[model samples]
Target: MNKRIFLSAPHMGGNELNYIQEAFDANYIAPVGRNIDEFEKQIKEYTGAKYALAVSSGTAAIHLALRVLGIKDGDEVMASTFTFIGSVAPILYERCTPFFIDSDTASWNLDPNLLEEELSQRAATGKKQPKALIVTHLYGQCADIVRIQNICEHYGVHLIEDAAESLGATLNAQHTGTFGKLGIYSFNGNKIITTSGGGMLVSDDEALLSYARHLSTQARDDAPHYEHNEYGYNYRMSNITAGIGRGQMEVLSERIKRRREIFNLYQKELNIIEGLSFMPELPSSVGNRWLTTILLPVHLSPEKIRVTLEKENIESRPLWKPMHAQPLFRDAKGCINGTSDTFFKKGICLPSSSSMNNDDIQRILSLLKPLLNC
Candidate 1:
C-alpha cells in the first residue's frame, strides 16, 4: 500500500526540535516559561495584534474570550452554524443561549445579511440582542468580515473571529482574525501548523487580554500564597507545546504557500469533472486552503468517495454538519436557509496535506477521475 494520504496534517519545519531543546536546556518545562512568552510575542507580531495569550486549546481560548467579554447565563450569543463545535461550545459553557447564523454561499462562512436581519428583528421585538457574534473563518477562508463587523458595530455586539482554520488567510490585505474584537488560532496536530495541541487568543485590548491571562492561569490573585477570588481554569499552553509553536511560526508562510499550491493543483485537476465543483474562493481573500473541498452532485454520496479513498489508504471527510442539524444543538435558535444543510449533504474534503507532492496529488486524482466520471 502507498503512504496514507491525509485530509490535512501537520508539516513540521526543521527548527521545532531546536526550540524544544532550548526549553529543556533552560528547564522551563511548565506552562509559564520563556517559550510561552515568546510564542505569544510571535503570534502578536504575525497577526498585528496588540496582545496574544497562549492557551491549552482553541476551545479554551473561545471560552476565555467569552468570559472576558462578560457573557453570562442566558445572554444571547450568535455563531456560524456550519463550523466545528469548538466555535459554539464556549457559548454553551457560559450557559448562554446560542443563535446560529446560516452560511453564505460565497465564503461558506457566517452570512452577514442573515446576521443583520437577526439582530434587527431581535432589537425591534424589544428582546435581548446577542452580546457577542462568533464568526468562524471556515476551511481557512476569510468570512465577509467587513460587512459583518459593520453589522456587529451597528448592533452594539462584540465580534469574536474564530480563525482556528484560517491562520494565514487574509481579506483585502487584512488578516481574518484581526478584524474582530477578539480572535483565536489553533495549532492542533491536523492544522496547517502544529504545536501537537495548542491555541492562541489575540486582541488589540491589552487590558482584556491581561484579564484573560489571569483567568487562564487559575485566576490567582496578587499574593504571597495561593489565592483566588474568582473561578478560573488551567488553560495555559505548556512550554513544550509553545516551543513547538515558536518553531512552527518560522515556516508558517511557506506552509501557507504550499497549501495554496495543493489547492490550485486539485482545482486544476478536479474542476473539470462533471457534477463536481470546488469551493469558491473570493477574489479579495487569500485562503490558506486548509482543505480543498468540493461539492458533489446530489446523486453522488460523499461517504462513497470517502470510503473509496479509505480503501486506498487515503483519508477524506464530509463537510461539517450544521449545528442546527446536530441533535445536541437541535433546540438552538437558527436563521435557517438550508445552505449549510445542502453543503453538508454534498461537500467532501479531499487530501490536502502540505507535505503532499505532485505524485501524491496525481494518484488521488487518478482514483477520483473514474469515480467522478470526469
Candidate 2:
C-alpha cells in the first residue's frame, strides 16, 4: 500500500530542534518561559498586532477572548454558522446564545447583510445587544472584513476573528489575525504549522492581552503566596510547545507559498472537469490556501469524490458541517442565506499539505480525474 495522503498535515522546519535544545538547556520546561515569550513576540511582530498571549488551544483562545470582552450568560454573540464548531463553541461555554449568520459566497465567511438583519431583528426584540462578532477566515480565505467590521462597529459589538486556519493569509497586506478586536491562531497537528498542540490569542488592546495572559495562567493575583482574585483556567501553552511554534514561525512564509502553489496546481489540473469549480481567492485577498477546496455541482455530490479518494488511501473531506446543521447547535438561532447549506452539500477539501510534491499532485489528480469523469 502507498503512504496515505492527508488533506493537511504539519510540516516542520529544521530550526525546531535548535529551539527545543534551548528550552532543555535553559531548564525552562514549564509553560512560562523565555521560549513562550519569544514565540508570542514573534507572532505579534509577524501579524503586526500590539499584543498576544499563547494558549493551550484555539478554543481556549476564543473562550478567553469572550471572557475578556465580558460575554456572559444570556448575551447574544453573532457568529458564522458556516464555520468549524470550535469557532462558536466558546459562546455556548459562556452560557451565551450564538446568533448565527450565513456566509457570503465570495469568502465563505460570515455575510454582513445577514448579520445586519439579525442585529436589527435582535434589537427590535428590545433585548441586550450582541456582545461580539465571531467571524472565521475559513481555509485561509479572508472574510469581507471591511464590511463585517463596519457592521460590527455599527452594532457596537466586539469583533473576534477565528483565524486558526489562516495564520498567513492577508487582505491588502494586512494579516488576517489583526483585523479584529481579538483573534486566534491554531498550532494543531494538521495546521500549516504545529506546536504539537497550542494556540495564540492576538489583539491590539494591551489590557485584553494582559487579562488573557492572567486568566490563562490560573488568574493568580499579585502576592507572595498562591492567590487568586477571580476565576481562572489552565490554558497557557507550555515552553516545549512554544519552542516548536518559534521554529515553525521561521518557515511560515515558505509554507504559505507552498500551499498556494499546490492550490494553483490543483486549479490548473482540475478546473477543466465538468461540474467542478475550485474555491477561488478574492482579488484583494492573499490566501494561503490552507486546504484546497472544490465546489461540486448539485448533480454530482462532493461525498462521492471524497469516498473515491478515501478508497485510494488519499484522504479528502467535505467542507465543515455548518454549525446550525449540527444536532448540538440545531436549537441555536440563525438566519438563512442558503450559502452555507449550499457549500456543505457541494464543497470538498482536497489533499493540500505543504509537503506534497509534484509527484503527489499527479497521484491525487489521477484519482480525481477518473472520479470527475474527465
Candidate 3:
C-alpha cells in the first residue's frame, strides 16, 4: 500500500526546539512562564488586539469569553450550527442554551439571515437580549463579519468570533477574530499551525484580558498566601506548549501560503469534475485555506468520495457535523434552512498539511481525478 495520506496535520518549524530548550534552560516549565507571556504578546501584536490570554484549548477560550459576556443559566447564546462541537459546547459549560443558526452557502459560516430571524423571534418573546452571539470562521474562510457585527450590535448581543481554524484569515483587510467583542484561536495538532496543543483568547478590551487571565489562573486574589475570591479554572497554556506556539508562529505565514497552494493545485486539477466544487473564498474574505474542502454534487455524496479516496490510501473527511445535529444538542433551539445540513452531506476535507510536497499533491490529484472520472 502507498503511504497513508492524512488530512491536515502538524507541520513544525525548526525553531521550535530553540524555544523548548530556552524553556528548559530557564526552568519555566509551568503555565506561568516567559513563553506564555511571549505567545500572548505575539497574538496581540499579530491580531492588533489590545490583549490576549494563552489558554489550554479553544473551548476554554470560548468558555472564558462566554463568562466575560456574563452568560448564566437559562440565558440564550446564538451560534452557527455548522461548526465544530467545541464552538458551542462552551455555552453548555456555562449552563446557557445555544440558539443555533444555519450557515450561509457563500462562506460556509453562519447565515446572517437565520441569525436575524432568531434574534427577532427571541426579542418578540420579550426576553433579555441573548447573552452572546458566537460566529465561526469555519474552514478558515472569514464569515460575513460586517453584517454579523451589525446584527449583533442592533440586537445588543456580545459577539464572540470562534476563529479556531482561521488564525490568519481576513475580511476586507480586517482580521476574522478581531471583528467581534472577543475572538478565540486554536492551535490544535491538525490546525493550520499547531503549538502541539494550545489556544488564545483575544480582545481589544484590556480589562477582559485581565479578567480572563485571572479566571484562567484559578481566580486567585491578590495575596502573598494562597487565596481565592471566586472560582477558577486551570486553563492556562503550559510554557512548553507555548514554546511550541512561539516556534509555530514564526512560520505561520509560510504555512498559510503552502495551504493555499495546495488548494490551488486541487482546484486546477479537479476543475473539470462536473459534480464536484471547491468551497470558494469570497472577494471580501481572505481565507487562510486552513483545510481544503470540496463539495460533491447531489448525486455524488461526500461520503462516497471519502471512501473512494480512503481506498486509494488517501484520507478525507466530511465537513464538521453541525452542532445542532449532535445528540447532546438535539433539544437545543435552531433556525435551520438546510444549508448546513446540505453542506455536511456534500463536503469533504482533503489533505491540506503544509508539509505536503509537490509529489504528494500530485498523488492526491491523481487519486481524485480518476475517482471523479468514474
Which candidate leads in TM-score?
1
Q: Summarize candidate 3's per-residue lDDT along 243-275 as a digit string, tens digits.
A: 999999899999999999999988888877787
Judged by TM-score relative to the true structure, which candidate is superior, 1 or 3? 1
Residue-level lDDT of model 2, residues 1-374, one tens digit each, is 88889989889999888898999999998988988999999999999999999999999999999999988899988888888888988998999998888988877888888888877776889867778989999998999887888888887899999999999899989999888899999998999999988899999999999998889988989887969889989999999889999999999999999999999999898888777887767778898899999898667878888888888899999999998889998788878778899999989999999999999999999987877778
- Clash count list over all predictions: 0, 0, 0
Global CA lDDT of candidate 2, please? 0.89
Worst 10 residues of 3 by lDDT: 365-374
TM-score of 2: 0.97
Model 1: how far is 291 from its true place, Å?
0.8
The 10 consecutive residues of candidate 2 with the worst lDDT sum are: 273-282
Cα-based lDDT for every prediction? 0.91, 0.89, 0.88
Q: Give the Cα-based TM-score of candidate 1 against the true structure.
A: 0.98
State residue 77's C-alpha deviation in candidate 2, in Å. 0.9
Off by over 4 Å in 1: none
209: Cα error in model 3, Å:
1.0
Q: Report lDDT (Cα) of residue 337, candidate 2.
A: 71
**Which of 1 and 2 is the better model by TM-score?**
1
Error of 2 at 69 (Å): 0.9
